[model samples]
Target: MTGARITVDYDAKALDAALSQAVAALDNPIDLMDAIGAVIEEAIDRRFDTASDASGSAWAASLRARQGERGGKTLTDTGRLRASISRAVSGSDVAVGTNVEYAAIHHFGGEIERPARTQVLAFNDAGRFQSRKDSRARRDGVQPIAIATIGATTITMPARPFLEIDTVAEADIADVVQDFLRKSLNT
Candidate 1:
């Protein structure tokens, strides 16, 4: 007699019950976002504190200090403390700008063959430079970097791929983005 192939079956009902219980224990999106926001706020506060030489000063104290010493203060260039935190949260090479659009994920044929990655780009506005000593004359200069924006977009992925959820809505993401701006401007 020829050997026959044998297959073993697992109980689907048991697996479903376990998965349901696990999902139930997961945190809601709002709660997760709030937690993230709190952490970000704390980091911003810390950076703001370190950037300023004097404690208890206003948020913009650091910027004012830099301006007083030099012609104009640049948050991106001079605010090392703020930059470090921003980089830590958003990742290195993240920057501020306008009219910038970046892809968070891309899929082929409605499914991802590879892992998803987030990309960020920035565009800055034009500006005119003026020196405190020479007030009347204007010179061409680079524009200040603005906050980068990220919006919601769907990306397809193959079955069993890792799941990524950004529970916060786009509006909320925009709000968090403003935190970086606030820190930069204040300092």
Candidate 2:
């Protein structure tokens, strides 16, 4: 959020004058939504492509993505995060967000792990990682993962912002908004 411009306030007199001439501008909620969504989407995409996948935070560059043993994208896989990013447009508002559970932790550096090694077993019914539930981890109907209680293990993931705006992104957002308004008015 270092370079993000959160508020845009227009002079009341100037807004009134423009409103009269561009009455049709921003009339449709979808136009406004699309414009806003595009700005956020493109900004995220740029970060993902940059490999750093972040800005604003000094720690952003420290957490480089690591590849898994099987060449899988692992923790830094932007594919899942990219796919999860979404937008919603309502009559009065526009919203952009990511459904990834770890998105917030990645955006802001944090310490993770319970006081104790909660549950190392795979048979937790409601939690995220169900060992038995995974077909690949099951061997002849037996859980492939061993059930054991490990000691406290903490993990520190640095902030890798996929949803922050830099200076260029701020300008891009303004241009997109302006273009959308102009086109909407002309139509």
Cα TM-score per model: 0.23, 0.62
lDDT tens per residue, model 1, 61-122: 32445667542442333543233332122422222211211111210124334444433322
- Count clashing pairs, candidate 1: 3
Candidate that scores best on TM-score: 2
Local accuracy of candidate 2 as per-residue lDDT tens digits, 1-187: 6876778787998777667656655555577677777778777776666645445433344323332433343234456876777778786476788888878987776889856543433543344455633454464344535555567878887766667666777887788778876765555
Which model scores highest in lDDT? 2
**Residue pairs with clashing backbones, model 2:** none
Stretches of candidate 2 off by over 4 Å are 1-21, 53-75, 114-148
- Listed per candidate, the RMSD to the true structure in angstroms reads 21.7, 11.3
Error of 2 at 174 (Å): 1.8
